[model samples]
Every structure is written in structure tokens, then in C-alpha cells.
Target chain A: MKSERANRRMMTRLSIFAVAMFGFGFALVPFYEKICEVTGINNLIKPAAAVVNTQVDKSRWVTLEFDANAHGLEWEFRPVQRSVRVHPGEMIQIEYDVRNNGAKAVVGQAIPSYGPKHAAPFVKKLECFCFKQQPLQAGESKRMPVQFVLDGALPADVNTITLSYTFFEVKGASTAPAKGGVQG
Target chain B: MEAVHGHTNDHSHDDHAHKPSGIMRWVQSTNHKDIGTMYLWFSFTMFLVGGVMALIIRSELFQPGLQIVKPEFFNSMTTYHGLIMVFGAIMPAFVGFANWLIPMQIGAPDMAFPRMNNLSFWLLPPAALLLIAAQFMPGGGAGVGWTLYAPLSTQAGPAMDLTIFAVHILGMSSIMGSINIITTILNMRAPGMTMMKMPMFCWTWLITAYLLVAVMPVLAGAVTMTLTDRHFGTHFFNAAGGGDPVLYQHIFWFFGHPEVYIIAIPAFGVISQVIPAFSRKPLFGYASMVYATASIAILSFMVWAHHMYTAGMPVEAQLYFMYATVLIAVPTGVKVFNWVATMWKGSLTFETPMLFALGFLFLFTLGGFTGLVLSIVPVDVQLHDTYYVVAHFHYVMVAGALFSAFAGIYFWLPKWTGRMYNETLGKWHFWLSLVFFNVTFFVQHFLGLAGMPRRIPDYALQFAEFNAISSIGAFGFGLSQLLFLYIVIKTITSGEKAADRQWEGADSLEWTHLPSPAPWHSFETPPVVK
Candidate 1:
């Protein structure tokens, strides 16, 4: 009888411990997420901002044509390209168009980079679709242009700067950088 | 009146029961002594296995060129050595000592849960086996360092999975062991022994157990997230997948930071017990020692982020961690001063345990000071991930924990074996280890400050000489450990019989009531404390 009583008491304590541990562990889950969100570190998926890209550089911006299946995107991007070299204090311009080939409207963010060391160029803009999430209506197309001068501060010995963009799907639309160009 | 009026207490002890002996006795043992013996031997085997891995690493690092192991293999050795030493050797060794001593000292018949104690110990062997087998897996054992940082670890091979599994099992074992310790202390003390009257070793275990309880599960959670991220495509840490990698670090150090103290605190306990007994004095300022230990455990949680200063935590966050890390020195300072104060004005004798205890006090304090310096964020930015950090921890752990363990063994081996060890060879073991250990790690601080990073198989031309010297010192230190093996074997096989009271000042209940080798079964009925 005494052993039975002891066993029963032990079971009670064990159950209590189990409950307490669960409560303690569960209490932490919500607290951790709230803290992460408030810190701008919420890596969890959220809606992206919207903006549209417009072609700004008119003349030197050579139009681009590429096979859509090759790059694995649902849109066609036409780019203005080809510059041999630029002397110091020269400007170059480029233009591009994104034609939506998908059945549904899409949202995305465009990451743009430039030069042999791509992604080092700091972009300044009068207007950009990238300022917020981008959204497009179904069966729609848009043109984006990036224009800028090669700063005179660039070393005279250096030559060639190529720009590239990899777009991530966002909630709405992407703003484009201004496009333009001159001799190298 | 040389105790002539005593009612033949000696013969009364003899009259109780002769101890059960040998292999069968150990297999089905519940006695703390038998279990402790098993733990000690097992831990030493692990130390050698881990040491062999260390030697492989050092040999590869003997010169700037890697002649022995490949880079992948070098990474494996570093990972395996750390895992084995931290889990397999030091922590188990301390638990073993606690198992053997806490009940004995507290005057309880056995641990609060004897059957569970056996189960907890038995789990370690299989866990170690699985970890070792991981080396033969598809890409070889965890190329990730002991930290096992995420995304990289997730991207690694099958070996990483196996290592994670091993960590999960080990964490469970630690939790069970720690819970057992906390329960035993809370429920099983003798009637007369208040918390204050409890031995310093028990006091230390109580605190260590608390640290283990609070942190080991966090480690479990961290590893759980790692497992999920690797297998289930959960973005707990992948930035591309909507998870932040730094979050993984925050959770890991929450566990990792206290984990070091978990290893160190019990070593502190061992020294606290050994120092006073050999010094022929009661421990000085026992209350303060208790407070200091408690304070250290509390502070361990606060200082986890100090490790993340380089992880790009906010500057304000860095400042907070830095200050908290340095403040740890105050309580730790109290501990060092208390140890020194205990030795002052006392009739101190340099017994084997005393020799090791004193070694811990000196070397551990130096290590702690370095730890303080590491906490200084500006200093740490340069020292982080360098050999200085390596040297600092080794001085604290190898010199501090391992030395104290050796001392504890020698001090108690007489009472456990009913025989005294050969004093001369024991002294040789002490001197050789102490001299060579310092030689090996002291130079590492210089190598670290000179901008050498750890965990690489090769070095620049300038680092070649120090690498050679450090390797040589390592070999010497490794060989001296064999001297210890000789002493223990020889003493156990044949030596002079010891009296029940092995040391004159030893007053724990183990010396009073239990005979040498304790018994095959004790506290089948609990002994009353008074």
C-alpha cells in the first residue's frame, strides 16, 4: 500500500513537470517571432512594393532581344547594348523593355548591377518603380530605361562597365533606373 | 584519554558486511564506488581517443606544410577532438565523480534514482559509437567545426546529419543526468546536514545542474532548427529562404556560452573540496563561495551575446554584452581570492590532490583573466577565433578541469580502493603534466596575438617554428598522461591497505560510514544523515 501510494505521488509529480515544461516551451514561440518582426529582421515572406520602369535613354540605348526559354523567365527583356570603350568624362545610355508573356499578373523586385565587378554601381534616379512593390495587370507589357553619366572620377586606365539585373518576384511592379550612353 | 572510552567503533564498522568484489559485482552494481570507477576509466579512454585526434592535427600542423592529413581531414580531427573531449571526457568525468561522492558526502545511501543513474551512464557508449562511425559516412564526419554553424552544416553531407543526431542524444543524456543530480540533492540529504553543511562539491553540482537544465534544452532546440532547415526546407536560417542565419547564432550561443561554465563549475567544486582538506583547514568564507558560484551561473546566461559581437549585433547590443562579460570577473575574482585565502595561515600539505588543486587555482585564474580580456570587445575583435582564445580555454579547461579531476582521483582512490597509491610516481605524474601543459598552451597565446588563426592545416613561414614547438610540447604532455595510467593500475592491482579515514582532515560521511569500495548495494535502505 505504501509503495503504491509512493508510485502514485511520483506519477503526479511527473505529470506536473511535463505540463510545466510544455508551457514554458510554448510560451517562448510567439514571443520570439514578435521580437524578430519588430527588429526589421522578419525574414518571413511578406508583400513586396510596386512601381513601373520607363525607358529614359533614347539614342545610344540599343534594344535587346533574347530567347525567353533560355533564361527561365516568363517575360521578354529587350536591352540596348554594345560599347567598345569610353574615354574619361564620357556618358553612356541604355534602354530595356519587359513584355509579360505569362497568363497572370506578376509582382517582383529587380536587382540591377553594373561593370565587370557587377553590382558596385550606386544608382540615383528621378523616378523608379523599385521604390515600392510592383504589380502588373494580366497580358500587359512595359518599357524601362536606365540613364547615367560615367563619373569623371572613374580612373582613366579602367575600361568597360556592363550592367545586369536579376529580378525576384514581388507583389507588384519594379521602377527602372534612367538609361543613357556615350563613346568609350 | 585517547578515545579509549569509544565503543569499538572500528570493530563495529568491520561487523556490518564485507564488500562484494570483482566483475559480476560491477556489472550489476548500484554502489556509487563501482559506478564511479567505471566512469573514470571510460572517460580516460575517451581522452586518449580524443588525444589521438589532437596529435593527428598537431602533426599536420608541425610545419607550415601539411604533410600528414588533408584539409578535410584536418577539419574532421578538430571537430571530433572537441566533441569527444567536451562530452565524452570532461563532463562525464565530473558526473562520475558526482555520482560517487554526492551521496557519500551527503550521507545518503545512494542517488535519489539509482536505476536511472545506470541508464543515463549506459547511453553514453552508444552515442560515442555513433559519433565515431560518422567519420566513415559519405563525406566523412562533419567538416564543420565543433560549432557546427548552420546553412554550411546543412549543405554538408550525411556526416553532418549523423553528428546532429549524436548531439541530440548527448543533450538528452545530459538533461537526464542533470535532472538526476538536482533531484538527488533536493530529496536525499541526511537529516542533520542542512544546505550549508553540505560539501562544497555537492554545492557546486547543485549550481552546475541548474545551468545544465536551463541551457541544454536550448541546445536541443537550436539543433532541432538546424535539422529542420536541412531536411524539411524550413527557413529557420537561410536568408534566401526567408530565414536569417544570425538567428541561429543567437540561439546557439544562448546554449554554448553557459556550456563552458557547465564544464568549469564542477571543476571549481572539485578544487573547493580538495583545497580545504589538504590545507588542513575549513574552507574560507563558505557563504561567499556559494554566492560566487550562483552569481557565475546567473551571469552565464547574460553573456551569451558577447560571443556574437562579431556577428554584427547592434553596437548598443555589443556594448551591453561587453559590459556583462567583463562584470563576470567580479564574482570569479571572489572565487580566486577565496581559494588563496583558504591556503593562507593553514598547515598546507602538497598531497597529489593538493598539487593538482593548486595547479587549477593558478592556471584557471590566468585563464579567467584572459577570458576577461576576451570580453573586452575591442580586444576581442582582434583575438576572436585566434589561438589566444584556444590557449585561454585550454589553460582553464585542460589545466583547470583535467588537473583537478586527476587530483580528485588520487585523493579518493585510497578510500575507493582500500589502498594508497605510490606517492613518488604520483608526484612524477603531477610535475610532468604541469610542466608540459604550460609549455604547450603558453606559446599559443603568442601565436594567436601574432595573427595566426586556428583550425588550419598550414601556416605561413613565420608560424612554422612555433607550430613545431607546440607539437613537441603536445607529445610530451600526452606521454605524461600515461604516467597517470601507470599509477592507477599499479595502485589498484597491489598497494598498502588504507584505513577507513584516509586523510586526517577528511570529514565527509563517506569516510565515516562506508568501507572501502563502498558496497555492491547501499541505501537499499536509506541511511539516516544524523
Candidate 2:
């Protein structure tokens, strides 16, 4: 009877440990998000905000193209202009129009990426809608502006640049402010 | 103890003489040996099934273009092959070894909970069936890879649901099995057989059982989240709904990394037994081996993020994980050194088991070195999802775990069956498996280094030649297992008779005290250790 009791005790203890580990797995969701928030790891929307001023490379014209994507959100998003030609250091402006097609109010955040990955450091954004979360009521439409200037030293071989923004719907509590640098 | 002895004495006639015969014997079996035998047979059947899938995958990659199967089916083969092999074949095989040996080694009557052990083993076949049946589900098996990272898994068809359920069942089985092992080892050892005095195999299984109980539920939770995300419109992994996909990776790898050790540590236990038996010496640094195995298990938890380096992380986190991942090599190195030192000055004989053990030592080290290489973030980013990663794991899995399993099977066959296997056929089995295994997987490192991504039906012309060679080796390796099957059957039915102590160096309770073909009920009256 003593050994049987001991066996049951051990099994109970292990079963509880296993159940606790199960909770720990779900707990990792929030725990990891907090780590990402504190550490800025894999937080793609947290842009590195830097403004570089130099002589405009008027001699070399770099073609900049804009693209927009809405991932799994009931929003119609598009860039107002398809492409623009600009000098390397010229501060240029572009617009994107987003319309919420869903019945309920929705909050979304935009993440930006560069065409040639190396071009990310060279392009500077003076003001961009991506710096904040956009909340729109049902059937609401809004036009957002993005202003940026390329560094005069962008690489001689780089003649073309493409800037892309993808908007993702933020579920649950969207009260927290968008993360990272906000110089607007 | 007297009452326990009385109970055990009632059933300890000759080998299986008092046991019930016919199908119902196994169907409702409470005997440890019967359950262990069932586990071994089931694991082998799954091994062959998984092996055939591997062969199918290889034959498709034998050429430069889509030669035989569609890319979709190819993806399914790779996915199911991984699932079946890990969950169905390797993990259960080690459990089989544990069931067969643990009680006898510790001089116990049986597992602490014999009925629970039966349920655990019986749970496996249905789970395996669910996994195989998943492939035929209306859009084919879930090709989200074995990790089952979400977004892809959520978007996958009905087959993903089946895979999730199968995983849930398998996890339950593993959890129950681990509980049985832990309780058996902790509560049921013979009088005076303190924890330290128990055999090395028992120690490793104890640690391994703890790990299984810890992480298997994490895996279940992950798959449960995936299940809910698929049907309930939850966004646990959908980035569009505030959930990040990388969150899934974090949780999966947290379970996944430890799962690797769940397979390998038991193999380590098996090798520890086999190596010393062949070398005719006591194990070198027994305490250190235990410490190293524990250290490896603990370190396994921290190094998980290393598996997802390319998935993106802060440079500091990357560096931290990178260093933490590399730190595992220290404990692993201690283990490898101990195995070598075990054979340093002893009277070594290259029996079939020893040959497999040596092969495990050599190739597992190679796998470990490659693992160290992959631990460097920059190097892993280059080799991530490539055949190089493929080559690394097969070395660890096939050569490391599977080879060790083979060694244990050969070493214990005589004790289990009361007959010696044909030595010549066994040697042939070992040599053929060794050569063919390398031929199959060795070139995969080259293909991976050449930038051939894994899980693809076709490869670029540059990788064509190596793919061809690897496929040829796979067929050879697959065929050799048949010879193993034949050898085992031959031994069980009509091989030469074996003495009580089949191997003079096997000094455990099973060999020292129990007769050949260990009695249906051993240690009926508990054997005092001191």
C-alpha cells in the first residue's frame, strides 16, 4: 500500500507538471510578444528613423515605384501614383488611399520594405502614415501621404528603387500607440 | 516485499508458460514483455512504412525535373515521412527498448502501472493510422512541414485537421508512457537498488521521461492552437489579426528542440549499454555521462530560437541564441569523449552491436559538428531549409538514433528470444546499412552546400548527380532492413541456443540473474542489490 501510494503520488506530480507545461505553451504567446516589444525583435513595423541631408544628385535620376498590399484585411488599399522619377536627395511625396469595406470599425498598421534590400538604409522617410495605426469606421476612406528623400550617396549602380507598404489588421485591443520613431 | 514476492511467484513458471495464448493475450496484455514486444514490432512496421516514403521522395529527386510525382504529392511525402518517422518510428522504438529492459534491469516485477503501459502502446497504432490516413484526405496531407508552423497550416485543407488530431493523440500517448517510465523507475526498483546504482539505461530513460512529460504537452498546446485557428476563426498565428507568425515558431521550436533530444538521449542510453558490453569495461565517467545528459536536456530548452534564425530576431537575441546553441557542444563533447575513453584500453570486439555503436559515435559526431556549424546564425541563414540541414539531421536521426536502435536490438535479441541471431547475416546487415546510409545521406551535405533546398520534387541540374547517388543509396539502405527482418525472424524461430549470460560483459540484473529468454515474470521475489 505504501509503494502504491508512492506511485500514485509520483504520477500525480508528473501529470500536474505536464499540464503546467501545456499552460506555459500558451503563456509563451504573450510572453514572446512582450519580449519582442522590449527587444524589438521581428517587429517589422518599427522603422529605423534617420534623416540624412546632402547635396541633391541632380545628375543621376533614380526612378522610385510605389506599391501597396492589404494582407487578409477587408480594406481596399492602393498607391495614388504608380511611379515617380526623382533626384537622389530630392524630398518627394506620395499618397495612398485606404477604404474599409468591412461593416465594423477596424484598426490596421502598415509596414514598409524596399525593393533592393540594400536600398533600405539609403531611403529616408521625413513623414509617413506607417508611423501610426490607422482606424477607420465602416465604409470610411482616407488618403495618407508619405514623404521621403533618398541619400545622395545611394550607389551609382542603383538606378531604380521601389517602396512597398503592406497593411495588416490589428485585432483585439488596438489601443497601444504604434511603436518606434515618430518624428511627424 | 513478501506479498509482492508471493504475487510474482504465482506467475513465474518458465518463459511464457503460464501466460494466456492467442490474440486476446496481446489485445488485453498487462505483461511488460508482451507490451514491449508489441512496441518493437509496431515501431519496425512504422519504420518500414516511413522508409518507403523516403524511397519515394528519393526516386522523385533522382532526376532534374518532375519525373514521377506531382510537386504537391512530393510535399506530402516529405511531411508524412518526417511525422511518421519521428512520432511513429523513432520515439516509440526507444519506448519499446525502455519497456523491454527497464524492469528487468532494475530487478522489478513489472512497470508501475502495467495497464497504463498497455493503453499507451495501444494508443500508438490508431495515431499512426490517423497520420497515414491523413495523406489520402481530400487535398492530401498537410505539407506545412513537421513543425506545422501556422498561417500555412491554417490555410491548408482538411488534411491539416487530421494531422493536428493525430499529433494530439500521439502527444497523449507519449505523456502517458513517460509517466509510466518515471513512476516505474522511481517507485518500483528492487530493494537496495538506489538511483545511482541503477543501470545507465535507466538513468537516461529517467531523464528522457521527464523531458517527455514536460514538452509533449507544449506540443499538444501548439497543435491545439493551430486547430482552433483553423476552424474557430481565431488568429493565434494569423499576422493580420494581431498575432505574429513568428509566435508559432517560438512555441513550436520550444517543443521542437527538446523533441530532438527526446529521440537522441534514449539512443545515448542504448549506446551507453552497448559500448561497454562490447568493450569489456565499465563505463568511463558514469556520473559525468549522467550530468552531461541532464545538462544537454536543460540546455535544449534555451537553444530553440536558433532553429528559426532566418525567421528574424534582434541581433542581440540572435547572438545570445547563437552562443547558447553552441554551448550544447560542450556536454555533447563530454559524452562523445566518454564513449571513446570507454573503448581506449579495453578488450574491444566488433560485434554487430559494437559496429553499430561505433558507427553511431563516428557519424553522430559528424552530425554534431555540422550542428555546431548551423548554430552560427550567419551559417544557418545560408543553409536554412537546404539539403545541408537535411544531411545534418539524418546523420543525427538515422545514424545517431536509428543506428543506436539497431545496436540495442542486436545486443538484446538473444536475451529476449533465447537464441543467437546469425552473426554473419547480422554483420552483413550492419555493413550494408553503414555503407548505404552514408551513400544516401553523405552526398546530401554536398547538395545542401550547393544550395539545393529541401522538400522540392525537382532540383537544378547542378544537384542532379548527387541526388541520383543519394537515391541509389536510399534504395540500398531500404533493402538492407529486409535482411534485418529476415535475420530477426530466423533467430526467433530457429537460431542457435544461447546461455543465460549471452554476453559475459552484460552484467545487469537481466543477464546476471535472469535466465535466457527472461521469464514471463522476473524478479518475482525482489533481488536485493547489495
Q: What is the DockQ of each candidate?
A: 0.08, 0.42
Q: Give a tens-digit lDDT track for model 2, residues B1-530.
A: 00112232335545444466789889898888889999999999999999999999998998999989888888889998999999999999999999999999998888999999999999999999889889889988888888888778988988998899999999999999999999999888888899888889999999999999999999999999989887776778876555677788889999999999999999999999999988899999999999999999999999899998888666888999999998999999999999999999999998899999999999999999999999999899999999999999999999999999999999999888888999999999999999999999999999999999998887789998899999999999999999999999999989898787888887788888877777677887788889
What is candidate 1's TM-score for chain B alone? 0.95
Backbone clash pairs for candidate 2 read: B388-B448
lDDT of 1 at A109: 46
- Using TM-score as the measure, the top candidate is 2
Query: Model 2 chain B, poorest ten-residue lDDT window?
Result: B1-10
lDDT of 1 by residue, B1-530 (tens): 01111222222233224444567656655556566767778799999999999989888888888698889989989998999999899999999999888877876656666666776777788888977998999878887888888757767888888888888788777776776777677667766778998888999999998777777777777777788878775666654334457777777787788899999999998888888888788889899999999999999989888876776655777899989998899999998999899899988889888999999888999999898899989999999999999999899889988998998999888877778899999989999998889888899999999989998888889988888889998999999999899898898888787776788777777776766645434343444555
Best by the lDDT measure: 2
For model 1, the docking class works out as incorrect
Global lDDT scores for all candidate models: 0.73, 0.88
Instruction: Give the number of the best model, judged by DockQ.
Output: 2
